[model samples]
Target: MSRHFETAPGLCEARDTATNAYVFNQTMLRIKDPERTLDFYTRVLGMTLVKKLPFPKMEFTLYFLAAIPDSQLEQWSKDDGERLAQTFGRPAMLELTYNWGDKDKAEVNYHNGNSEPKGFGHIGFAVPDLAAACARFDSLGVTYVKRPEDGKMNNIAFIQDPDGYWIEIFSPENLEQGLSEHLGSDQDQR
Candidate 1:
């Protein structure tokens, strides 16, 4: 299907489209050990150690990881356990703890075991800008596994966090000098 940036063609796209009227916020990963999982995210992926909280009367802890401050998310995390117990209906985020109380516990990860399924797998996410995001990864010394590639509908790229978690970034348009072979330009595909 043909896609255009603008809804009416000549005019600009709607305001909500910039941040996305919809976006996947958080993903709760099931880790054999939460501590090890923490290591991979903060140290490897470079997402700031955001927040952590104990699940009342349980051996588990809930962590909130994010690349930026999301105010709406803070409300969900800080709610009481009884409320959170009701909200775990989603697949990814486990719970939301109060930002003020949990920040102190967040820290960097030190890889100690085979991350495997214990940590997250290849998570594809959108960015504000595609090429700029890849450049940030480059500056952080994060190895770019697959340079950005343009699709018929989306721009994409791949990279690995320090823990060996593969991440793919997707955007609405083309990456300036992204990998082009993914298109039918590939002789094999053609």
Candidate 2:
């Protein structure tokens, strides 16, 4: 036997007024080699390296990447401080934290959160064309955890990053089709 859980109710109306201004920002990941990780993200994934901040005293650096449109990139501020402020203001960015001297070490200093004691699952990206994106990834020799046609959820695919973090990929059309079919099946069950 199995159990179905109901969706959690929304927050109180009073709280909505205070929380409406909140915006979800970036997710940070610890990287071993900044060069390799940056190459993978910027080259393979087509993300723009918006800002890079080095802290010599702290012995760490922060690299911010975002999937901003090329048109928007063209209009970005020429001033360094303003550009950084713009990067900070944007949502849905990826922050890679690179500790000094970690790249020189033979062993990875941080866990990818998918092995042994698992915690953070994965981050996802929505592409315009799933098939073409997967094909491009194949050409680039990107490691796949699950191909689009591999399992029950054939509409989605998962690929690994340089640090072994899983990145889920799917297109809007496929996601909508899958969701509609799933919802229809659930309606039949009810």
Candidate 3:
């Protein structure tokens, strides 16, 4: 199967119909301590643990989490491999992998990709109210890479997980309003 689309005048772009059929499945992050990371994600961030795959022989475990209810995940778990694939055809999830004995050993730590030269930037979530979320994080003692009040980008803030990976937080309304106010004036010059 093929589709022909036009990029501009006299430009015929052809592509296989199956070429772009893709969906974001999951983002995997290595964790040093399962208990502490799980507590941070579940208790502080309000995410539900959907699935757990433990490979004792391989000496590692994979935990899939989402902002979904347990009942919904239970229903999805009833499906077989093929059925599950079909059902979750476009599922977006977070996978946390923990190596065995890392929690017991104090010297084990993963590079958070935010050192001298940054690699992976950050993952983001849009909250209902940014102020309330930051307040709750303060009470929970979550580490902040950039607090809303501490930076020039006051609309968006960055918080670090137990593993030192940054999670960007913002409210959709605030972000959009800020972007509109800032970017709207630039159109006049164009």
Candidate 4:
């Protein structure tokens, strides 16, 4: 179905002509350093790695990490894949296959982020104690980007990784309200 729409720099959105409307469906993200990124997602964000598929020729690994719902595990195990995802991924269940290194060098997961004359704005990581996390970063000489602040958030802060990529240290709870606010209307966060 060639729906000739303005294509973003990344992959084109698949479509259906019968409805002539944008459909929300599964999103597959490709990333570099899938293992490291997967570890970060699971450890720092409390996600569980439910699946792993490695492609040596592609020098990449696909990891599916989902934040389980409060429902009984028996029920989820009995549910269909599509249903499980719909119930859980609505707010978030972002997936990725980070290649960190392909063949000799990994392909970029263009979806990661793009900065104007700079690096990614930042990716948030959940931490128990902002101060303690900051201290650890300090010990490793990770550049301090910002002191933890309320930011209208329960607690959050910014930091720069060794590669100069911006990182946000935040609690999962802090995002609940902000997310709802963004969904409410056209509020320019940027």
Index of the highest-TM-score prediction: 2
Residue-pair clashes per candidate, as listed?
A: 8, 0, 0, 9
Taking all chains together, each candidate's TM-score versus the true structure is 0.45, 0.87, 0.78, 0.45
Q: Estimate every model's Cα lDDT from 0 to 1.
A: 0.53, 0.87, 0.80, 0.56
| Total clashes for model 4 | 9
- How well does candidate 2 score on lDDT at residue 86? 84
Best candidate, lDDT = 2
- Cα RMSD, each candidate: 10.9, 5.0, 5.0, 9.1
Candidate 3 ranges with C-alpha deviation above 4 Å: 1-15, 69-75, 78-90, 180-190
Report the C-alpha lDDT of model 1 over 39-104, residue by residue, as the tens digit. Answer: 655664445444466656664566766553355445444556654443433333322222232334
By lDDT, highest first, what's the ranking? 2, 3, 4, 1
Write candidate 4's Cα lDDT for 1-190 as tens digits.
5556544356556755676643443346555555555655555445665556677887667666666544633444434565555444444445566563542454333532446555446656677666777677667555556766545443567765323445678667556655565453324433
Our model 3 lands, by Cα RMSD against the true structure, at 5.0
- lDDT of the structure predicted as candidate 3: 0.80
Worst 10 residues of 3 by lDDT: 1-10
Better of 1 and 2 by TM-score: 2
- How accurate locally is residue 112 in candidate 2, as Cα lDDT from 0 to 100? 69
Pairs of residues at least 3 apart in sequence or in different chains that clash in candidate 3: none
lDDT of 4 at 171: 60
Candidate number with the higher lDDT (1 or 2): 2
